[model samples]
Structure formats: structure tokens, C-alpha cells
Target chain A: MSLVFAGACSHAPGITGRSERADPKLREEFYRNLGRIRECLEAARPDALIVVAAEHFANFFMDNMPAYCMGMSDEYEGPIEDEEWLAIKRRKIPGNPDLSKRIICDVMQKIDLAYAEEWKFDHGIMVPLHFLTPRYDLPVVPVNINCQGPPLSPLHRAYELGRTLRAACDAQPERIALLGTGGMSHWPCTPDSGKINVPWDKAFLDSFIHNRREDLISYTDEEIFADAGQGGFEIRTFLTVAGATEGSTGELLFYAPIPVYAVGCTVATMAVE
Target chain B: MSLYCIQKLLYQLNRDPYTRQRYHDNFESLLEEYELTKEELGAIREGDIGLLYVMGVNGQILMHYSALIGQEWDEYIHAMKEGVKSHGPVRAGIYTLLKGSES
Candidate 1:
């Protein structure tokens, strides 16, 4: 079975770019966090990475929206800058369809969950990729959740999905790593922007790293929504990490709140027993 | 009213009241601008923010209506697309709704 190290991440744009004009302090923190993540990846050396993140209108729409989608593609793309980020293209990655199929089948049969195919990667997947594997050489299997839409998966459901994903990864012979990317706090583009709920965000980061599944699971949607603000759409990433590290413990690697992008960026490593 | 309609209505409530009044008054013209139908209008009149949100009405339309009815458009778009890139053509309705509406 492959190892799954998962944790929450921030997807704010300013943090992802390498412009020298950015805030020096925030940029310093970003690089610091990036270095830490690199250490984790080197240690894990996963043959394949299963990334779970939220979709930002990247693939689905009103015409045909899927509550959950999985990328079965051989390659994925990062964010674009040449064409104003809109022209950014996806690179091909090796997808384990057999594993993907197994995961899909098991989740459906066991949990009454269904997912759409042909999923694409967005910033939720890209930010971590840029930070963790900037070279774009690693193979990744992408899973996306429709956090913006109603009928969001219950937190418990997401946890269960993670557990199932862990099982699926175990079923595969190759070693794997799972990365969950999103936020801790801060709203995008509002008067109260850049505000960080330090205490609450820290609590979440602590619980996530310590593998406080029961406590994390106990949180109500309203509670998370209240804490995360609109950007709280990121909590889904935590749920993904939780699922990947089923019954294991997590270690807090780093946590920093970047006021520039209004995100409480954090990273953690999960060691499944 | 359907859940969709109720959600849209709530979204209207979240907008400026003057904009809501103008929407109530010139419902047809505004609906036409958005390519909305009577059913959709009925949905909005009933305060279906989710439906309106799902229907892809530009928040700017709300701002325009707010301006017409002498209300403030103090809100701003955060420019979230600043650093992100797209892998392909993203769907429109949901993106449009999310782009135009306030959180």
C-alpha cells in the first residue's frame, strides 16, 4: 500500500505567483511553507499523487453539473499567464484508471456515492502542484468536489469518502501520496478581506494535523461555514485529507495566515498506521 | 414556490432594497436583458436567490438596478482570476452567477 500524506492548503492567486513585487513577508512565508512541503514530498517519494480539491467553475456548469467529479485523464494543466491565465493548458499525467475504477466502484457500491468522469484540474489542484511539484513531472489523479453548489457532501460523507480512497490506494500496488488543498480562513474581495480568524483557524489546523477526526467530524456545516466565510469552500480539502488518512494520525508541518490574499495557508503530513 | 425560487428570493434580499424595488417595477425589461422568462421572474419576485444565482444574472445587473433605484453599489469584484489559469473552457452559467454575485 502507498503512503497518503494529506493536509489543507490555500489557493489564493498572489501566493501562487513568483512576482518579486509581492509582499516580502508573505512571500517569505510562502517560500518557507513551500520548502517544508518539498521536504515532505522528498521523504514520501510517492509514485503517484491522488489530489483532492474543490472545483471553481473549471469544468461543470448549469447545463450539466456533477456533485462530484474525478479526473481519469493522463495529464493535467496548471494555471495560465501567457493567455491571461485563461489560456493555461493542462499537461498529461499518468492516471491509474484501474485504481480509479476500483475507487469509483467501491465508493458507489459501499456508500451510494457516484462521480462524474473526465474531470479537469483547477487552482485547487494546481496550487499544490505548483508548490509540491513545480516541475510538473509527477503523475497525479485528480478528484474534484462541487463545493460552490448546494447538496454539498456532509462532512461525515467526505470523511467516509477519504477512508474509502485510502482503501482504494491500499488496493493498488504502487505507493501513493494524497494532497488536499484549500483554506483555513479569510474572505475574498470584501471590506473584511485579509481578516484572519487566527484562533479558529489555528484550532482547525491543530485538529487536522493531530488527526482529531471525531472532533473534526463533530463540526456542523454551519459552524465551518461561520468560521471559514465564503472562502470556506476550502474545508472540502480537509475532508479529502481526512479520508486519505483514515484511522491514521497527522502532524502539523506549518501554518501561516497571508493577509495579502486573505487566506490562512497551512500544510500537514499524515502518517497512517 | 420551489426551493430554487426561495433561494433566489433570499439572494434578492441580500441585495440592496432599492434594487429590489426597481426589479419589481421594471421586471420585464430587466428579465429581457438577462434573457429570463416569466417563470424566472416569478422565481425572483418570490425571493429565490439560489435560482437567480443559478440563472447567471450578473451582480452588475443588481448594481445597475441599485443605481436606478438610488442605492449604493459599494461592493467590488475581488479579481480572483489574478493568478489562476484554466485548463479548458469552463462552463458559463455557474461561473457567471458566482462571478456576478456577492458572497
Candidate 2:
């Protein structure tokens, strides 16, 4: 069975982009947390990691779109602007094709869902990849949720999907870990752009790593969206992690409010005993 | 009220420069559309950037208001810092902040 590590993630714009300049303090904090994640990855040493996250208009468009999509390919790209970084391409971490096929078949049979054979990794996936595995050698099977568009999946449904994904990962003997990335809170644009939800962000982080799955499952999308601001809906990605964990405990590592970008960025790791 | 509505309003403000002036000229109408109270309108008009920050309005909305009132980029950034500082940190995505704040 795969061990799942899930928590709130912040996809700060500059951090995800090719910019070399960074807040020295923040950069140190990010590397420190990445070190911890690297340790966890080494200990688990899973054959594949089923990563759940959102897509940033890179794959799907305003036209034909799926509420949920999975990357079934053998390799994918990281977010880098320079042709050099792009040229030093990384292969899609191999996915358990048999397991992925089964999960897709089961999800389609059981629910009104859709799947995709190809998906390009966006900042949502890339930023974390840079931190989780800077060397870009780790293989990951990616699953993306469309949290931005209308008819978005509700919190409960997202959680349930995670649970289903967990079952699928477990069906295979290959070890796996799950990573969910996104936000704590921020409005995304306006004079008040860099606002962070100190109280709410902390509370969500607490509940997430502590295996408070019920609390997360019961949370309404409206309530989260209201408290966490517009970017808050990304919580659904965490729910996916919670499901994969099968309600296991997680450890909160870092929480920093990046004022420049208006996001309360956090990094956490969850594992099963 | 809803974050979606707030986001939609901000999106409109960022996309259209004249909307800011329209907001200033017909602040009452904007309030009616958003169903904001007098205090809310006053809060935004008086540059209560902190209160505005907590209200979850985005940069595009502020830019629209600033442009409508003929405020320059420097002035807009100043007001934004003041407002954002009032509340600690704003939660908007970094990309939006950079794009909206850039001259």
C-alpha cells in the first residue's frame, strides 16, 4: 500500500517562475522544508507518487474541459522558462499503468467522472516539484483537478475521490506517496491583494496534518472560500491527500506569509504508520 | 458577499480602466450592485486600505478605482502598500499581484 503525505501548499508566482532573486529568509525556509520532504521521500522510497493538484489553464481551456484529469504518460515537464532548463527535460515518473487503468475504469463506472491520457504540469505541479525534488529525478504520477472553473467538484466529492484514489494505489503492490499543492488564502488581485488568513490558515493546517479528515470533509466549499479568499478553493487538493492517507496523521513543517505575493505559504508532510 | 462576486468585481476593475472612474463617479451604483453599505463605500472612498484589504478586494479592482480617479501608478502602489500593510498580508496569488501592480 502507498503512504500518503498531504497538506496545504502555497504556489507563489515568483517562486514558481524562473526568477533568481528571492527573499533570502524565505528561500532558506523553503530549502529547509524541502530537506525534510526529501528525507521522507527517501524513507518511503515508493516506486511512484500519485500527486494531486490543480491545473492553471495550461492543459484544459475555456473550451472542452474535464473536472478531473490524470497524467498517464511516462514523463512530464517542470515549470522553467529558460531553454536550458526546458532542454534538460525530466521524464514523467512512471505510473502503474495497470493501476491507473483500473482506477480510471472504476471511477468512470462508479461516478460521473472523466480522465485524460495527457496533461502538462503547470505551476501548481511544478513549484512543488522544484522543492520536493529539485534534481527533477523523482517519478510522479500526476492527477489534476479543475478547481478554477464552474461546476467545480465540491469538497466532499473531492475527498471521496481521494479515498477512491487511495484504494487504487493500495491495489498495487508498488509503494506510493501523495502530494497536494496550492494555497492557504489570498484574493489574487486588488489593493488588498496580499492578505493572508492567519487564523483560518493555521486552523486548516492544524486539521490537515493531524488527520482531522472528518473536519476537512465536513467543511463547505463556501465556508473555505469565504475565509481563505478566492485562492482558498485550492483546499480541495489537500482533501485529495487526506483521502490518500486513509486518515493518517501529518506533520506541519513551515508556514510563511509571503507579503509580496499575498499568500500564506506552507509546507507539510503526512505519513501512515 | 461571496468571494466569487468579489473576484468577479475585481476582475472587471482590472480589465477596464474607465471602470474605476465609473466606480468613483457612481460609487453609489457600484455599492448597489455589490449591495455594499454606506460604511463600505465610505471605507473604500476614504482610502481605508486596511478595511479594504480585509474586504478581499483584489488589485484589479483597486487599479480600476485608481485609474478612474486619474491616479498614477506610483500613487496606486502607495495606496496598495498602505492598505495591504493595514491587514498584515493579502492572500491574492502572486501572479495577479505582479501583473496588476506593474506599471
Cα lDDT tens digits for candidate 2, A33-145: 86787677767776666678776555664356677877666566554222232222434444455556666776665445566666567566766776676666666777878
Candidate 1, superposed: residue stretches over 4 Å from native: A17-22, A80-94, A189-191, B1-34, B37-103
In model 2 chain A, the worst 10-residue window by lDDT is A80-89
On the 0 to 100 scale, the lDDT of residue A86 in model 1 is 25
lDDT of 1 by residue, A135-164 (tens): 777777787766665546777777777887
Clashes of each: 22, 26
TM-scores, all models, native as reference: 0.70, 0.67
Quickly count the clashes in candidate 1.
Answer: 22
lDDT of 2: 0.63
